[model samples]
Target: MTLVLKPLAEQVMVITGASSGIGLVAAKLAAARGAKVVLVARNDASLTEAVEAIRAAGGDAISAVADVGDIAAVRAAAAKAVGHYGRIDTWVNDAGSAIYAKLVDTPLDEHQRLFQTNYFGVVHGALTAIPYLRDTGGAIITVGSIASDLPSPILSAYAASKHAVKGFVDALRMELTADAVPIAITLIKPAGIDTPIAQHAANHVDGEALIPAPVYDPALVAEAILDAAEHVRRDITVGGAGRLQVLLGTHFPALLDRLAGVMIPAMSDKTRPKTESTTLFEPEQRGQERSGVQPGRKTSVYTAAERHPIALRSIALAGIAGATLLAFRRSRTRK
Candidate 1:
């Protein structure tokens, strides 16, 4: 089937986890770009508020309250999108929850719960959206994390769930290709973006749960998601530091592990009091963009790399050739 996706202005987008964080930003951005949007989340109140905000901005939007973790709920939500908008051109699995605890410290049930939302939720979204997307060849964008590439000390369960998400996305993409399916599957791995996730994460540590420095604005991630919806790429890392971390973990796994073991503990704030507020079992009502975490850096190298890969590769090759030539000349001079 020769599938050509519709333009954003003519497409209908369904974004899960649309009540807050990067998901909310992506919904707003997509609606602003002229796409009719369907917002899905577990919280009815927050979903209504998000829809209202989008409508207030003169964008077309509707809300469906569904927990992505539940297959039936996800399918119902997909049905609602199709019923209301007629069809879904883009489906984003951005609904996820995390836990801040050592693997041993985290309860088995808690770990299961986290995976239910992070991994199974994505699976449900993909499975439910695939049939609708298969006919027209649309996009499925899953929000993964840098943890998918490199495991973190305090967030082992969360990291593992992200790994599962990556695995599922990879295998599904391969299967779709083999079957000649026209759907575009994309995995977006973000570094610690400023999102309410940190505040809502279930923490089993001595201090308050927090995402470390070098945080990025959630808008950066939302932009990447929207871009993937329009121009489907297989994988995209959000922050420059995240790209660096992936590269290091890929090439120097042992060294990266050793460094992370020490850095993770040192970077965390141990003095802050632990909070009881968490969205592990239920959704929180705080509806806002930007996690309130001040970004440590203002630039995203990953975005730059993605936007100008050829130019960056050329520069890198030139540098390597120049160094090689200089080394040869010095060797001859020494001889």
Candidate 2:
């Protein structure tokens, strides 16, 4: 069955993790485009600030203070959105947390807590949004990571949770399709976007935690999520470099395994001392998009190409033809 989603102007969007990072960015963007936004997060102050900011910008927004990991809380958030806006046309599962530690070094309880926020939070958000989305053929966009495709050295638990997220999202998509559900499900696999997540992650290492190099602006991810809201996309990767890394990991697992020695240490910011700034068990009050670690790239050619595959193919075909013509002329001249 074909799924038709309403435009952002006419939709009511419920976004988890909307107090900061990509979720907040998306909520602001959606509100600007005339969608009524319901921002959900554990930090009431941040959520209220975000909602007010949107309102001050002449956009419609409301705050829902709830943890995405709790199914009942998630359900209540959904009900609140429906109660306020009359319907939920889109739901974005963007709440996530990470740990900067190896599997052996990280505590088992830490791993479970990370899963509660990352994996099961997605589970709760998706299940809670399904019935609402089914009503009017809306979209559910989950913010996963490139870690869903490639495993990281120090972030083993975070990677595992992302892997689980991808698995569950894929299976749920298939099941929904088989049952002829009109809800569009999209998995957004972002590379290291310049978000506060790295700084907020539970640090098991001695050094300050950091997202790997080739970090992208969180706006790119927000764009992808908003695009998936109006359009049906199975999955999207934000950065070209991260996409290349995933490809390398897929094709040369042994090579990535061998590179772990260098990769493990590089994932940390050695220049700074480690601080106890973690939101693994509880929420932090800080709300910002970029982590200010490094400047993030403003655009991604690969992501644009992925969004417009036909145009990408046309460019490829033209390049091939031009190369073939040049070769023919060179051969003729040589003869």
Candidate 3:
């Protein structure tokens, strides 16, 4: 079935993990664009602050405090959205957590908790949103990671959970399509984004956790989410660097295996103290986008090209033709 998504201005969006990071950024952006937003997260204070801030900025938004891992809570959050807005046009599953440790060193509980949030949380969000979305012909956007395809040595459990997420989303999309459900299912595979996830991670690493080099701004991901909400996309990797890593992992698994030693050390920052904070089990801090570890790029050319492929290709071909003509003129002049 062809899914026709409504314009952002005419939609009611429910975003999980909306207290901070990419989720929070997307909530604000959606509201700013005239979507009535329902922000869901475990942090009550952060949700309140985010909702108040959005309202203060002349946007319509409300907060629903619920852990995405809990299906009942997620359902209640969805009900709250429908109660407030009368219908749900888009549901974003952006709630996730991470653990920084080797698979062996990672505790079973922590690994389970990571899956609960990162994997099952997405499952919960999709299942909860599907019924309401069916009535409105809406979209379900899940924030996956490049790690969904590429495994990280130190972040084994997080990678595993994302892998599960990718599988679930793929199968669900196909099943829904076969069933003739009109809801759009999109997976957003982002690269290392500068968000508080590192600070909020359950770190078993020796030093402070970092998202590694080539991190991107959370706004880039937020843009991708909103784009999927308005337009149908199968999946989008936010950063070119991340897309490259996924390609490498796909085509040259042995090369990545060989480079593991080099990649392992890059995941931590010894200069800073090991993080004593963690959001794996509970909420720590909220209402911030960037983690301040690095200044991420303001834009991603890869993502821009992905979102507007034909337009970008037109520009690229025009530039190539112009460069060729210039080179021809230069050769003639020299002759």
Candidate 4:
């Protein structure tokens, strides 16, 4: 068995939204493991801080302040990574936003911005990485969500955006395989990690945030992401609940479709009333940045429903097993 591990010294990692949350944690882990990292995010200051922190910890890394919304900027960032490191081994499409509101309350450009980062940003990164990455069997990892797996009307746009990301990554994975490209694509689904994403969710005119979210730990997701990079698994679930949702949704597709309508509303305790706006990452509010890792929370475990893996094998197995058991029981009764 030939196990080809990504060489930490030669492997260069490019991460989006490295200024915070899972991206930040993932950067730390990669650096600790001896990979040269390139940090990309809108906040140049925060990106600098992350780079310095990593360097202080005896890790090699660089920072690029770029927004995923701009293809030129994304491409430039990718170029910059290769320039510094001479080669890029892994590229992660993690720049995304959840700032959303009711469909009726959504802005005309809401979907545009979502795709700018969520879908198009990934496309841009993938395109940028292709030329330089083709020879290295590089990996593309995108942080997806449970919302993508199971769409909900309340956050339809966010879910839709994620669904699009899933589609792109899935198709790209196969295309790369069929073409015999060494690059591996992985779609990472995270149920919820208590990142400041909710704080950054777009708000309406009434001070009410545009989207609501649940909490999940960022570190666990970071670990899972690194694991994916190492193993090149097609996809991974970041939470237990996420895993369950993928499982139940597959085994009982119709039932899940029906249940989602009844279940999605429970994700948030409150919804927007009137045109009020809410806090989302602008700071001085619920969206304040997390400076250091919190104590005792390095292990935020998710329920089965939250880790909605993009890979459907487990869900398929469960469906097949259930069907077989049901058929056996019916045959026995008839006999």
lDDT of each: 0.86, 0.90, 0.91, 0.71
Query: Model 2: C-alpha RMSD to truth?
Result: 1.9
Provide the global lDDT of candidate 2 against the true structure. Answer: 0.90
After superposition, the stretches of candidate 1 with alpha carbons farther than 4 Å from their true spots are 1-3, 296-298, 325-335
Model 1 score (lDDT): 0.86
Worst 10 residues of 4 by lDDT: 279-288
Model number with the top lDDT: 3
Give the least accurate 10-residue stretch of model 2, judged by summed lDDT. 284-293
Clashing residue pairs for model 2: none
- Cα lDDT tens digits, model 1, 1-335, are 55566788999999999998889999999999999999999889888989999999999999999988899999998899889889999999999887888788899998999999999999999999999988678999999998898878888899899999999999999999999999999999888888788777888877767776568888788888888888768888888887888788899989977887676675346787766788778886566666665553556865766855687688789989999999999999999
TM-scores for all candidates: the values are 0.94, 0.95, 0.93, 0.78
lDDT of 3: 0.91
In model 1, pairs of residues that clash are none
Which should have the higher TM-score, number 2 or number 4?
2
The best-first sequence of candidates by TM-score reads 2, 1, 3, 4
**Model 4 C-alpha lDDT versus the unseen true structure:** 0.71
Backbone clash total for model 1 is 0
lDDT of 4 by residue, 24-115 (tens): 88898899999899999877767878889999999999998777877899888988988888988888888777644567877767667777
> Candidate 3 on 1-335: residue-level lDDT in tens?
56778999999999999998999999999999999999999999999999999999999999999999899999999898888889999999999999999999999999999999999999999999898877658899999999989988998888999999999999999999888888999999999888888889999988899896688999999999999999999998999988888899999999999998998999998888998979889887665877977778888888999899797788779999999999999999999
